[model samples]
Target chain A: MDPQKTGFDYSTFNPSYFQHLEQRIKDLDALGIQADLILFHPYDSWGFARMGQAMDKHYIQYIVARLASYKNIWWSLANEYDLMAQLGQKPLSAWDFIGKTVHQEDPSGHLLSIHNFYDPPVHKGTTKNWFDYTKPWITHLSIQSDNVFFVPKWLDDFQKPIIFDECRYEGNIEFGWGDNSAKGMVDSFYRIVLRGGYATHGETYIDKPNTTRPIWWAHGGILRGESQKRITYLKQLLATNGFNYVNPMAVQGPHWELAVGESPDKQHVFAYIGDNQPEFEIFDFLPKDNIYSAQVIDTWNMTSTKLNERIDKNHYFHIPRKPYQAILLTKIN
Target chain B: MDPQKTGFDYSTFNPSYFQHLEQRIKDLDALGIQADLILFHPYDSWGFARMGQAMDKHYIQYIVARLASYKNIWWSLANEYDLMAQLGQKPLSAWDFIGKTVHQEDPSGHLLSIHNFYDPPVHKGTTKNWFDYTKPWITHLSIQSDNVFFVPKWLDDFQKPIIFDECRYEGNIEFGWGDNSAKGMVDSFYRIVLRGGYATHGETYIDKPNTTRPIWWAHGGILRGESQKRITYLKQLLATNGFNYVNPMAVQGPHWELAVGESPDKQHVFAYIGDNQPEFEIFDFLPKDNIYSAQVIDTWNMTSTKLNERIDKNHYFHIPRKPYQAILLTKIN
Candidate 1:
């Protein structure tokens, strides 16, 4: 926190210090990584101390309004937080303010929200009370392993388009650390899209993930651009799929499966088995005409392959269970 | 990242001392996270090298042998690797090692798998020929999000326990730090369980989390913890009541009506609407015996009323549209 901006050692960064933040926002404008709630100032103890109840609410109002001035940045919100409440914390209250102030300036509200996790939403109905239907709702990127893809259910009921407020990449290589240490990067992506929802990642070291050490960037993999390259494809593929068609349904066979996108109706059927060398078939109950042929969309290279005849209803073509591959069988049309 | 045992070096914890090479893995026992990985012996480079194979059936042999010693660490097998023909990165191979080496050590092979978002298993049934069906499986985890609880679908597939393998928890308050950071810790719990699985998180710091940020635990509110408290609770609840109970069918109604919890039997039902002010009797549905008594598990402490609801098909209860709370209506026991 560059505390000089707010004057108390300025934990606030003026529109000055890093041209990167502004440029990145512009690039996001170009790439459409636009959602709301981008945090510039992290936990500023000084700012928090001086502002008190007025501290963040006033600062967030300043931050969001300033960012709102530029179309490049649409999300205007703060931590509106509550993860650690012991510090006389008041992020959520500020969110109440954000909910009120943001819409007053931008009707569509620029897809904004605050960041939170470890803690579920304390202020749920506030957004609906303040912003109109067009305004997006804010929510955290649920990170617990058991909470895999839990946000969709939260958002489904939230009655608003949720921007995954904060999703961190973490990996702990036993021996404690080093190479292959961070997690929450690509794996978190799998959880996000199971229900055809969207979420964002807060890269630990934004500009250069490598600048960090054994744990942050870890291994020479960063040199290989391992995390970056894979995530780009995932983001594009999920975004391209158009969430509507990817509804959640239970698909069980010799093994467990969760699938999105129905076979014929949506012009395609996509099935994903989360784990196991699930021995099963492609078409167990086909209505004949709905079968257009099965193709495995290998996400790694975006590889597309058409299957031969073993994939029929009676045969139960063996699906050599692999992780997160999108199998789509188009309508014969 | 163990600054003490990381085997790496830092320029007094500043940018100039960014660590590039690891010291050495003299004894495999001291290899994990105990010793620093950056303190490369200025006089020697290859002194600290992990045994990874680009060339033989015994490829993962060395590391496997070490882990077989039964250390108490969650291990992941390969890093984010894909066999790409177009990029001349094809001729890829890895299965033999994981099957023989990793599997032998951890019967629950998922503890080790590739870290990826879009990448599928290239090692599944390849010619190096090391995969079999104790479960022919692949593990998936999305280290994509900044949210600690959010996991990608790739890791959600484990019909059994699955480690998030790679998650990022820097405890950096770039957004609003502190307890807000706990959201990642809390969300990470439910995210994995709802997917019918168990999970893990990755943290980044110079020392053991407990040692450094003694309070920064990855629990209901921090980046460090003895166990994922809330995550365990949520997962236990879902597992106890079939995961399918939380399926999301559709949102139909005047308020924000939506359904979640999915099971093959479709016996369990969860529904929520955002009209907290609605005036409907709890059991407006007559002949409540026809349907299961709805039990709303206060997973997120949203309610403390207790599980005491009598039911009938005519149940018309007023519920608020919220997150982390689910209502289960099952056939009466």
Candidate 2:
């Protein structure tokens, strides 16, 4: 527990910490939430972040052995692992050893990944500072980039489920990584989800002087952002439509202006117009022979209106000329 | 002017074409506007784009001799010169020759430049396909990118005047490059101008079947978009304030989230909260020793409201918590 120690004393380790973690995992599992446990982080004043490789390996093995049996557990090896490496607390080989140890120790074969910090100078659009996601022990990619439009390329480059775990939170905090507006957050989610990836949400609203409420991103408390409900509506929309897999239609003509996606069977199509507010769009990208029922979705207001006119390749559909609008088309016959 | 011909006969070259260009240049000069004449383009079937080096040199010489006498004329050697190179109509060496020819032939020495087509695969953040802006003959940059956020980087890299001449037009056309909403266009202008660059505006709303109207971007017509007034307002604001040179405050703390800029003398500071609707921002970035008057500008509404409270490093300035709002601070003492 000393701040200057370089090794963990196993005999003096508290058992109550493991018990609290288990109880929290059980509670999250009951609520149908996956416990994405971050085992290492650089934002520490204690000596845990500076522990040498041997003690770090022992810590990872202990946690994986005790927690991997739960059905809803995702192992995040570290939050901002690159930052830790930059500070000389750990090296790339240390991360590799820790990852391999977790992969071998976990009996349940849970999802294992490492989150990264996006330092623009070193990690701008390139994976120069990222942990090797192509390693067999890593299950998926937990990225920290604000450019959600690049998700399609990342998905193509590494054939794994990509989760933008930190695309800048939805709040009014001063930091750049924590002060995106609600509309910005919703747009990022739609952009990523429509391109067959996932986005995580966080908030960092500074509380008033009298109120002692914790910021949602640092210490979990009551949710105070407007993006949560819209995100839930998006989730329900995807689940109801049975769109398990949607890929961006980059080769199609309209994809350049709109975030257009299509299901594998070519029956469901959706396009998210993020900031462009065109009054009307010609639906020439639709199939020529198939008839489709069109619906306009106001992502911000969480409203869906079915258009009276059925759409085909020849028809032009009029829109409300507003931002944060989407169109969903389902094959009718 | 024949579509199939590869050579130009000087005897048959129309004198009226030169006269018409001179008249147009005079008209634009009367309005205090610069005529950015594009000498060559690839969107042609007239074989002008594929003209050999000899004819190309002759054409450049003729235009520069006839047009460079006007003070308002800016020599854009070619529009989308990279696309011309990609299509094998002109290589880089040919463009260099054309630019050098224009530089040498123009007796009046008008501003000379070349515009580029942004093919994402080849020119994403890297200047691989861009014309060598470092050449002595080139005076400024005319870019075709929608990412106005990268203007600051381009300004640093090239150290030349940057103009996003084709950051997508404000319209409802079918083409991606010709269809951005009015709000989108205004936002692009603000982002670029705030970062000490310039942006050009265009409109491309498709007309009804019965009405035969030309697209503004293709053939000059009546103005229709809402962005023109806001851009004019921004121009007046800058002109009245005498901010001839403003640089981005990237090293400051709040610049990561807000588009903050300062005049070279640091007597004027402006921040554009483009899409972020923060309720209140702590004015800790301001100098503690100076007293300043603050104003909130509704960029889209073209309205400015002066605040009752003065600002310094100690005060927290509250905002309207809406999109497209800006804060302007002027040191009074």
Candidate 2, what DockQ?
A: 0.44
Estimate candidate 1's RMSD in Å.
27.7
Whose DockQ is greatest here?
A: 2
Q: Which number leads on lDDT?
A: 2
What is each candidate's DockQ, to 2 decimals? 0.01, 0.44
- Enumerate residue pairs that collide in model 2: none
lDDT of 2 by residue, A1-333 (tens): 344563546435567989998998999899889989998888876778777777777788778878888999999999999888778777767788888899999988999999998854335546787888999999999999876666667777899989999888888755667779988999999888887788888887875422376677657767889999999999888877767777766533334567777777788888888777566677676667988898999999999999787888776767776778898889999
Backbone clash total for model 1 is 155
Q: Which stretch of 10 consecutive residues in model 1 chain B shows the poorest summed lDDT? A: B118-127
Interface RMSD for candidates 1 onward, in order: 22.8, 3.6
TM-score of chain B of 2: 0.91
- Per-residue C-alpha lDDT of model 1 across residues B1-333, encoded as one tens digit per residue: 223354643222222222121222324336443221111111223222222233222434444444333443334433333322122222234334544455565544434343332211121112122222125443333232223222222223333333443333423221111212234444444444443333454433223212444433332233354235555565565566666433333211112112233444655544332111112224322233456666655545534243466655454444332334455666665
Judge the docking of candidate 2 as incorrect, acceptable, medium or high. acceptable
RMSD of 2: 2.8
